[model samples]
Target: MNDLTKIMVSKGGTPADITVGDALEYRAALQEHHAQSAGHTLFYAWLRRLGSLPDDAPATLRNPSRATGQVGIEQLVDRCDLTCRPVRDLMVDYLTERRPGLDYPNAGQRPRSLS
Candidate 1:
């Protein structure tokens, strides 16, 4: 990835008040929770990552806040230049959000796409 994206990805760790494991676990929960739903999870995550989210983005892209997406977007933007994380990571996040019959907590609305 480009230097800018590296900077972005580096910022996604847990807050000073939280541990790394805690932050990862929380992100895992969000990914899994959203996965329970059918359709559009990946797309929503991508929109969140791109900062072009719709008003409903929070619910759909729960757990990781805009901060997460900002970091991800930075990574992606850098990646877009140097291919840091594969475009597939975005697709992966979207696909991982499939929980099928599981009930998802309110993550807020899904953000719309920039493209």
Candidate 2:
């Protein structure tokens, strides 16, 4: 299989704190998490060699007050880049899953392509 597919399959499930921290920091955390959690034994071993996540890593860091809404945007764009899912669809799916009872305030407007 391809590298992206391998990575996707390895990720298994999304972490609860995936949406935490600054956009760039969150992405870094995700990369670290994915590398560590990969299902492939070799991939997991490789990550282990890279060392464990820092105690202060942003993934589990609690700083919601600093959230700029850019975290989700960056994740969506990255997922779309990997999976080739349309940005609008991924945005809808993310909102639906992350905040099930609430609707996105900007839902009335069409989403822009991440291309």
Candidate 3:
């Protein structure tokens, strides 16, 4: 990232002063605040519109869109594989339920086959 300067501007007879550290923090805080406010606003608005969705509604349907209400999770899974993650979870599970004699790191490494 490039270095940004904090400018002290004279706006409408008022002098605004900010330091370098203040500018970076202000930018990040502003972005995070926007994201949180948007999430809260959208959640309440959608909840007010649609009382409560049934269990059959897919995960993708969590967000309300302009198209249709019947779009389910199967379509989402078909369009995009949401489970394409690293083998960290499988490694954790294996480590949790490992036998003492088995050499997990050097020898047999049994994991959930995603591919």
Q: Which number leads on lDDT?
A: 1
What tens digits encode model 3's per-residue C-alpha lDDT throughout 1-115?
A: 1111212231122112322233334345546777432332232223234534334333332333423453433443344544644444454455445533343344555643333
Candidate 3 residue 4 C-alpha distance from true site, Å = 15
lDDT of each: 0.43, 0.42, 0.36
In candidate 1, what are the lDDT values of residues 7-111, reduced to their tens digit? 235555322222323334544654688744333245444434555544443545345455334354344445456454576566545534543312353468554
lDDT score of residue 66 within candidate 2 = 48
Residue 64 miss distance in model 3 (angstroms): 35
lDDT, model 3 = 0.36
Query: Between prediction 1 and prediction 3, which has the larger TM-score?
Result: 1
**TM value for model 3:** 0.17
Model 1 stretches astray by more than 4 angstroms: 1-15, 35-115
